[model samples]
Target: MEYSFGPLIDENSKILILGSLPGVRSLAEARYYAHPQNKFWKIIYGAWGKTPDADFDARYRFILGHGLALWDVVKCAEREGSADGSIRNETPNDIPALLAAHPNIRRIIFNGGFAFAKYKKYFGAPAIDYRKVLSTSPACAGRDREREEMWMEALGRSL
Candidate 1:
């Protein structure tokens, strides 16, 4: 059973970015989007016309400073590999409780189809603004312009 990391969030956070769960590399490193190929940090930094720092702690601070928070939909799950298709017997995170506790969270941006689907399955439609952006995983293939535009639209515009 693979477990997700604790949420990188605080009372100042306005946008909650949710993924399905961490992949092998991220789990190994105990960080979000730790896979070198993942485009999460790239897209986020691009939103502010900056570059991601080499250090994970710096990146975490950057996200927090931007009023963004990160977490996963699945608290724990049995899965044979990183592919979303392999996920099963999943236990969901207490998203509703989190939302209630953090009333400043005005939007939820699912990091991919899997995260969005899982959120719907567990919490139904949330009372706040929510949308699904393209996955930043390397599994999605080809770091293309469309991905940039989509992610920029979701996170680049405003907090």
Candidate 2:
């Protein structure tokens, strides 16, 4: 299947953001952080004191300004819908491909716990250095705005 949103990557990217899969809004809009309420945009903007408006282009620019790259773990996955539980056996893209392609990547920040849990095998004990694996952002489930802001600050420092 053709990807709705191509990865917004560059050779200068120092931080990689990974998610389990894109949600409906993301797929429909062909952009990452399409869900306005997802807080991904707000968190990133807040870290840099940018206003989180409804404009998608502006948001993407803000992210790119910070040298952040975005992508999902499962590039081609079968899901009844956007629900993570509906995901089935799927083939993920070659993450090492990204790693190799972007030699400047110094940190890998999983957006949520799900992606971390799913890709831990390849990332957990692998020979690849884990020092670049930053903490899971608090924008994910159970974490509130305050926590998310804290994570964003930490992430900014790493980037």
RMSD of each: 1.0, 3.5
Instruction: Give the alpha carbon lDDT tens digit for every residue of 114-156 in model 2.
Output: 6766676555532343222322333345656545665565476
lDDT of 1: 0.91
Q: What is the lDDT of residue 14 in candidate 2?
A: 81
Write one digit per residue (lDDT tens) for candidate 1, span 83-155. 9889999999999988999999988999889999999999898789887888999898874687888888887
Question: What TM-score does model 1 achieve against the real structure?
Answer: 0.97
- Top candidate on lDDT is 1
| Prediction 2 global C-alpha lDDT | 0.66
Backbone clashes in model 2: 0
- For each candidate, how many residue pairs have backbone atoms clashing (under 3 Å)? 0, 0
Regions of model 1 farther than 4 Å from truth:
none
Give the 10-residue window scoring lowest on summed lDDT in candidate 1. 150-159
